[model samples]
Target: MNPALIERLQAVDRQAESMGRGERSAYLKQQAAELGMSLATLYRKLEAVAVKPGRKRRSDAGKSELSLDEAKLISAVLMEAMRRNGKRLMAVRQAVEMLRANGKIEAARIDEETGEVLPLSESTIIRALREYKLHPDQLLQPDPVSRMKSEHPNHCWQIDPSLCVLYYLPRHGKDTGLRVMKEEEFYKNKPKNVVKIEQDRVWRYTGTDHASGTIAVRYYFGGETSANLCDFFIYMMQAKQDTLKDPFRGVPRMVMLDPGSANTSAAFKNLCKSLDVHVQINRPGNPRAKGQVEKANDIVETAFESGLRFTEVNDIDQLNGLAERWMRYYNGTQIHSRHGMTRYQAWNKIKAEQLILPPPADYCRELAVSAPKEAKVSPDLEIRFGGRVYSVKDIKGVLVGQKLLVAKNPWETDGARVATFDADGHETWVAVPQVVFDEMGFRADAAVIGEEYKAPSHTESQQHAKELDKLAMDAETLEQAAAKRKGKAVPFGGELDPYKHQEDTLAARNTLYIERSGQQMDYNRMEVAEQVLSKVEMAKLLKPRIEAAGGDWKQAVALITKQYPDGVAASQLEAVFNQLKTAGRLKLHKTA
Candidate 1:
């Protein structure tokens, strides 16, 4: 309400109060005519101008009839019934009813007047759920996001892969040409056509420097796969040959991406590890964590891919060529909204040390998919990998016979890196140079046998072994101990019986085998004399014959038992059972 209008309405109300009741209606009508409104509008304006007290709240206005625990139970039931996409499949009323009926929740209320217990209404339950923030809508919302920043260009890069919606490359003889995915042919209804062109559908991989917003887009055939992701990542890192046009190339300190299969693939992770790049995979369904690259994807679709409809392209190479030109032009010319400068200009602020260049494309491709291999350190303190011996003696904590993870060093051609874990289980890499041999086929550092003698330094294990020997032999020097023993000393002073338990277990096993063999021999002797058949065996043999002869099995069993007081022999029981069944003395009892 306007202050001046409110003041005028208040003055009118005061003047009406001073007038008699008969004169008040005419005065309000005259004021309404002057204000270009009806008498009812004037009265309504007066009511709006007047300060009214708020409605009286109940003693338990904010309190819920349903307890917090009951509301949570109702929420759990509804949330459990929700679809994975967060669509509520169960209504609040349905959930409350089901929970109450199943005794999972109780929100019973005592009627004050009637002194009867009553269950909470659905409305009350819903109000409580919302008030307690246990509703499905509130519980299913995405977590709040915090803004992320990169200190400098190449400090952090965000990468994402998306399927291109507009164009797919169709092979024309040996060449490929771009074609639009029309609704008539490549729609949901035309699944066969869609599948036929699945391999040709173009996938776009977009990367952006988080600080500078320099976008690098590349197109590949098929969907998002490890190979395509690696290729794009390598392209983003390796220095471009045409630096004048596109200078945005360097290995970022960290790469932010979603937890996509390709982004989190073992091959991709190995590559990132090899490049010394930190891989920051955001939580699933959290794309805003790498919003820069996600937005870059959209920009490419609108600013670059939108132009493809007006141009003709041959093959993926030509398409990539166009994309490269556009990327350079856009980054070099258009001012970024965040920094108020062109992306290339902001990126050029990168310090020399901050811009870490990548290895050649081929080497990087190898690094991307290659996992570190475990190689055991030789007695000579060297490890053999890729048919080359690399000395690992200088690496701290490296021991002979201990396996170390070895990978090709990206920075050095004839060197390899050894991976070792620290106390905190974080991986650290130590570069090891390949061993070079002189003309004598020996290591260059090896001592000349006739000219000089060089005793190898004792390793930690050797030192520890010496200390162990001193304690075990009770001698200050190993030589003194050897001489004192004279090769006749018994280890542990012959007191410890290392094999006593083994011998005891073997004797017990032998005794068990002997008992088992004796029992088996007795059983075999009984079988040779024809073992007596049990009641079950007699019935099994007689059942088929009795059924064929229509004889009663009970009567047959009685006759067998009377003839052979002891159980009949297995060989003779079958013949006796057949005779009884054939004698017609064991007929099945007929029903009345």
Candidate 2:
């Protein structure tokens, strides 16, 4: 029998052993037909190697007089020879030669009747290897085929970034100036370095729908980055062409991607979360998870990019224009391999019924990548982002240096949206401030209102400015006074300590005396302030100590010394401990 036929029969037999009697019979019949064998021949093929119970071996089954142990030792020696020499042990003749060279045959028992030494046969060795189930071709086995599939259009979209090299005209010194020109002037102006023959490497982002094979490709001059990915994603979702229409318009149910720098960014993850889209990262070392996009890249290299050799591409825009045209031709005209129809046609067949479009304009903007950053609000209620100052108006009571979340406008960088986060990490929109510039150029908190000038006014604006200046001066005075009174104040500053001066009105009230209390019932505010602490203010200072100490006073003392390094006196530490205990904030054991 042919080796392939025998192998097929063995595989079928193993599978059949696990089936029910009826199923086994039906399976065997079907396999017989598929293998172009008669039922009797298949059954005979299966029975030839069937396992037998309690079968006795013939006394002379092996002509060789070697025992089973000696046979195994000979086989081991043969395998070692092949391994050491980096060769295959396929023939019994090779094994026999190795065994004789190692002097194993010299000790073999002679045949009693023939008076000659018995030789090892090829069938005996082959049968022994088969009986032990060792496979010589194990390393040559093919990888299991991937069965990943999408059921409908936009069910899964694969996105990837690739780099391609092409030729473009280099810009001259004059051509590189910052100036807006007409289309004809921009493209027709011949640069002195037109034929410089420099390699123009461009980053290309491609997204492909798994089911319908619809694709969208975009080109950029920069490397793979979060901004580039976001821009291309937006273009792929919104831009429409007359030839291809909007075959790849809907938001994918799940976007599959490899673990690339741009794809794994926080901005990208945030965008997916905002859009309510699931993201799937390919397994490490398994790039075939997004095979559709990879195939599309191969097509671009072979079909679209090869066609660009004859065209004159001068800039990134021109390259993108060519890519846009090529994408339409590829997606709208060429037939897909699996679907046997144009991707556009296949997509349109089910898109209207199955695909889900993106959210409304406002929601889409919210879902777009904003690259959020946490920043401190300045004293003037302003935050700096991207080298521009943005001022929040009507923020009189908001604390200076408070952390606020600032995110850029996805489509532009001129201004950003500011938000305030609570203790629970919930963000609420606070302001959408405008960029500030002034007579001296980009002054802080000065709104840029284009080319308009107005006469000075004595309105609320000036009054607010004056109030801000007064507060600033008072703060500076307090800081200087705190520096002079450091030992009596807190560690960093005396800004919130009790010894810091009380409010002006409160101090005046404490100095006043009523006629009924002419015996001098003066309220010493300083003594009162030392013992009284608002729950909020008290918690703010004690929480860290409580957490560090974990309710152990000695541990807290050590931690304080480690943190402060100036060495707090034991008496002062005990006083604060007792104060905190009386306030029901913490318990310090008396033993300490």
Model 2 misplaced regions, further than 4 Å: 1-142, 166-200, 239-244, 351-354, 359-592
The candidate scoring highest on lDDT is: 1
Task: Estimate, for each residue in 107-146, the C-alpha lDDT of model 1 and write its tens digit.
Answer: 8788899999998787878788899999887898878878
lDDT of 2 by residue, 286-352 (tens): 6667878999988887888777666555566777787887877788889988979999888787646
Model 1: weakest 10-residue lDDT segment is: 513-522
**Candidate 1 — which pairs collide?**
552-586
- Candidate-wise lDDT, in order: 0.84, 0.64
Stretches > 4 Å off in candidate 1: 1-63, 112-115, 172-176, 422-424, 438-442, 446-592
Whole-structure CA lDDT of model 2: 0.64
Instruction: Give residue 498's error in model 2 in angstroms.
Output: 51
Clashes of 2: 0
